[model samples]
Target: MVTNIAKAILSVLLAAVVSGCALGISEIPVAELEKRYASNPPLYIDVDGLQVHYREEGKDNDHTLVMLHGILASLHNWEVWSRELAGRYRVISLDLPGHGLTGPANFEYNTENYIQFINSFASRLGLEKFTLVGNSLGGYFAWNYAIRYPQQVEKLVLIDTAGFPLKKIPFPVRAFTAPLLGEISMHFTPRIASSILLREVYAEPSRISEAMTERYYELQLRPGNRRASQTLFKRNLEILRQEPSGLEQLTMPTLLMWGEQDHWIPADPHLKRWQQALPHAKVVIYPDAGHMPMEEIPVRSARNLHQFLSGAEITDTSE
Candidate 1:
């Protein structure tokens, strides 16, 4: 009877494995996902072998603003802020390489690749010189862009930027950057991971809704998006190891905004570093906000941004 019981347990385990394999989560159709997530169908253009996706709104005068989204975040994150700024300056936003409808492109896919992509995209769009704004990973690229091509960026805005090393990496980034586990995760990621990420980014858990989390999950499953995400996470880890140089060297009129309650990377240490590096930078902190202050307090952030832009003269950085 004991031997029969052991045999039954083994049989059940084998059946479970088979069942899991059969019922594995599969890629959702891009058409279906775009229906809900792609609120506005972005205009596409080919840039350096990738069919780039971007939106250009607001006035077409010389005043221009180029915005970049964070890791795993698309141009949609700037929806609220875009509405506020688009009326005056020409606001252009994009999906950088590995994220959004832009899809994944074959490249080294490092921070450098992003820098080059930005250059190419701007060149193709005939962007002479524009204020550059970025958040999180987007902010990481923004500073690097400013440092490398100072001639192209008129002003810099960093929202919870990620150029410096971190005390602890976020779990989604950690999990996706792991070796074999990262590979397996592309196929079997749990839906709950999206909820956890959303909650961590926002100060108030109430801000995250089921529909928001659902959209994030659906976007991650956008064909090659998961694999691109893994590559981006791994590459960023490698970049963050080295302390970035030339923070003080970025002399462009700078704006640094931080959410005081940000859990990912605390405000004090990073903000202090920014203050030391860019002494003349205009700083703003939001008390109740988390990592995503732009989303949490769009109107306030927009008002601050407008005030800064209005006061400062738009320099011809293209020279």
Candidate 2:
């Protein structure tokens, strides 16, 4: 009986290994990714020796809006917002060093390095001052940039930003940060994993279209992106551990937006903490939205942003 049980366990383990191998993903060529995702010719700029993927849209105006996406997300996440705001304001979105088509970076993906990189990118674009907008980890960068370089930022918008220390690391992030598991994950990341993450970010899973999932999964398979993302996760863990400070210094016109259904960075305590820090900030909570209000409910969220920037009364438009 004992010998039979041992054999059964071995059989199950073998089956699991075979299943995992069958689902393994491989890196997609950069050219192919560009063809699928980019315009006639992909827009790229040399920042810190890396060919950074970016998009600049809207009318040529003095008022500029620079948007940043969260970790594991690309500039494409801001497509709706960029389109809605582009008519009035010069909107620019970029794939950060690791995420999106930007792939890996020459320098470290630490806190200070990213801040400097943003500054360099802005300098290259000859942007004197612009409204800085970011979501999730991008929001973390936005607030920090506003705090560090107060004069250059006219306004700040943070959507489910990460500043406060997390009680526990999310499973996906934790898995990618682990030594052995992280290396394994780089090559074996399946499409289902990407879909699950996308659903988690949306309060309603129905909002995640098939094309969106495909884009995310394919981007994760972009050459050099997985390794860079792994490195970023490790660096982010260290940064998240440090207690958040300097928030009180963000006296600029600040707009804090959070999704009430956000599981990643729940609105309860984190929103309250941000409120206390930036008492003057205009706060908006989307009732039916999750971590990404911009992506989940783009139209209403974009309207609120316009109202905030235009100094109009923020109406209760919950969708």
Candidate 3:
């Protein structure tokens, strides 16, 4: 009877092992992913002890447009805007500390670290001052950087910025911002999830294409990218409080753009606070767009940006 009991115990242990294995993450070949995704040859620089990758385009003699992209997004996301704006101005976009071709460094992925890197990056590039433009997380950095280094930012553009305390945070954002919960997803490759998340950001789902999915998937798997992502998301919840505290200090000429259908950040409540804080701000709301107006409706947004940058009073085109 004792022998039979021992055999039963072994069977139960094996069952438990199988059950755990059932939830194991699938293995992907990083080599194959990189071959297709790492297409762009990047210009390199050493900023804040990190080897940074960036793309510099447009005329050297023209005024500069220094662009920053959102969380988990790379310099590639600004490809369309950079191309369109480069014709008129010097356009430079960089992969943030832990995003894109740029590898991770030993620093907290918080606003302070990002702002320091931005300052160092501009100084290295000999950019005394330039128009600062950012989307989502990048926008949060842009506005704050304006406050911190008002001397270095000539103008400010915020696209669905994330500096305020969100009244109703989205499911994916809430999940990834939770400490242990988000880190758990770090082990899994994000190719499929990237597509899903991209879909979530757009009012029209078809905008999440195969090419976009491939790029986001492979770039995210870059060494240390996944871990940095978890750290940034968890730390972002902490920064939201710190972000709004100094909005009044950002007195630069500002342009605020929002997607009316933005699920990530609603336009109505936040815009009111932004206007209250920066009384010298201009606001535009896009009717048929979502979180990513720069991508969702690039040309129309371009018209607006071009007007604003040219010091022309911007007319609302949402009607």
What TM-score does each of the candidates earn? 0.88, 0.92, 0.86
Question: Comparing candidate 2 with candidate 3, which one achieves the higher lDDT?
Answer: 2
Task: Give lDDT tens digits, candidate 3, residues 1-319.
Answer: 3235433543544464556643234433545544554435537889867888788888564688899998778888777787788888898888888788785766887778888989999999999989999999899889888989999899999998887788776545555665544555565443556766677678777666788877777777777777787777777776654547878788888999999888777787776778788889988888888888888777778778988999887875742
The sequence of per-residue lDDT tens digits that candidate 2 reaches over residues 58-124 is: 8486789999999889998889998899888999999999988888998988878889999999998
* CA deviation > 4 Å runs, candidate 3: 1-18, 22-40, 177-180, 241-243, 316-319
Alpha carbon RMSD to native, model 2: 5.2
How many residue pairs in model 3 have overlapping backbones? Answer: 0
lDDT of each: 0.80, 0.85, 0.77
Q: State the local distance difference test value for candidate 1.
A: 0.80
Residue ranges of candidate 1 with Cα displaced over 4 Å: 1-23, 39-41, 312-319
Best candidate, TM-score: 2
Across 184-279, the per-residue lDDT of candidate 1 in tens digits comes to 667765676677777778887887778778877878888899999998788778666567787876999999989898877679788788888889
